[model samples]
Target: MTEKSMLVVSAHSADFVWRAGGAIALHKKNGYRVKVVCLSFGERGESAKLWRKGPDMTIEKVKAARREEALAAAENLGAECEFFDLGDYPLRVSDEALLRLVDVYRDVQPAFVLSHSQKDPYNFDHPLAMHVAQEARIIAQAEGHNPGQKIVGAPPVYAFEPHQTEQCEWIPNTFLDITEVWDVKRRAIECMAGQEHLWEYYTRVAQQRGVQAKRNIGITVKRDIQYAEGYMRLTPAVVGDLS
Candidate 1:
């Protein structure tokens, strides 16, 4: 069993599953703890998938459905999920709110923190989430620079891929093999009925990533699998004597 747990900081409800469902499922199957912090209920730019199902869908109804989908997806991946109820679209974060996010990091005290990349040119919330997550990660250490930060160890942080981010030079500093857990990833993605339309596309994204990884020698990776995930480290992960 993997001893370390991971905290996933997402801009919206479905972003986590879309980017790292394979990784999340891989961790869970290895007995690692997984927690998701959704910065928003995906009220604005992201809720269209649900609201479009019925023209009369109210804001409250759409939110409720999205939450259910998030929970179901997390359950499918064997991880605990929580929604922060933060504002969507124009993601505004106050110092107080960011500190609350710090509290989550301290409370969870995860060894690994995964979040959205900061370079998403198209999505406003994605960059905001990245900022909050980056601050929370640094603050979690409670170093001398920021006395207002929550007291916790500085966990290793990584950024997951996004749609626009793929073309924006995402150099993965770390890689985790998710071949065995690919099926779990597929199932977790299937839980998002509202966004079911994009599931296959995401699956293909993973497969493409796997193919890219195959070029590296001395790492025997099977080509039959059709799913993979990638991440770039925000800070170095001191695992052992890699140097």
Candidate 2:
């Protein structure tokens, strides 16, 4: 049997941990190999705690710290993490970087893809990441685009929740019940020491999503869901059965 796999394209090193740690952990527990690609280390924009430590903190130092944290977080969730090191004050994705991402899609042949929301006015990087992810997915699916490499399967793309869901205009069409793996997710969250302030915020987000999941499924099931992650499906799902 072929092994199941997932690909997550995050704009920042710690974005995956914040948004999809539960999903990653749950999928890993279910026998899926998860691969995370962080387009940028978020050293410039997201490393407030590290920057606060010293006035002369170099970009390399910030990158190193964030990379270490990201690796630790990925480890806690049983996923492999890779860095693009694209740099991020305004997170730009060059043509080379886009091609590299397309290469990853072909190589991994992911069963599904996760990425940032298409609209995030507060953080421009999030939207740009989504754009690149979508383009890469398209290019990867075209057989003629890269003649030597095998064309990838058409995997559904899911946009994980942003920090400010209301401002981002994100709607959750998929709610993942991650109650069993909440501990794994929390451990992953704790790994991101630079962003300690967000720990409680994400935990609460999970709990609220769990409540939404419970309501969406109805009250008759008697589920005691304590944590969950929500996603917006960006592609049409092809299913064998309606149920």
Model 1 lDDT, full chain set: 0.79
State the lDDT of candidate 2 residue by residue for 132-180, as single tens digits: 9999999998878879889888899999999888899999999999999
lDDT of each: 0.79, 0.93
Off by over 4 Å in 1: 1-3, 143-150, 218-226, 237-243
For all predictions, the C-alpha RMSD in Å is 3.0, 1.1
TM-score attained by model 1: 0.88
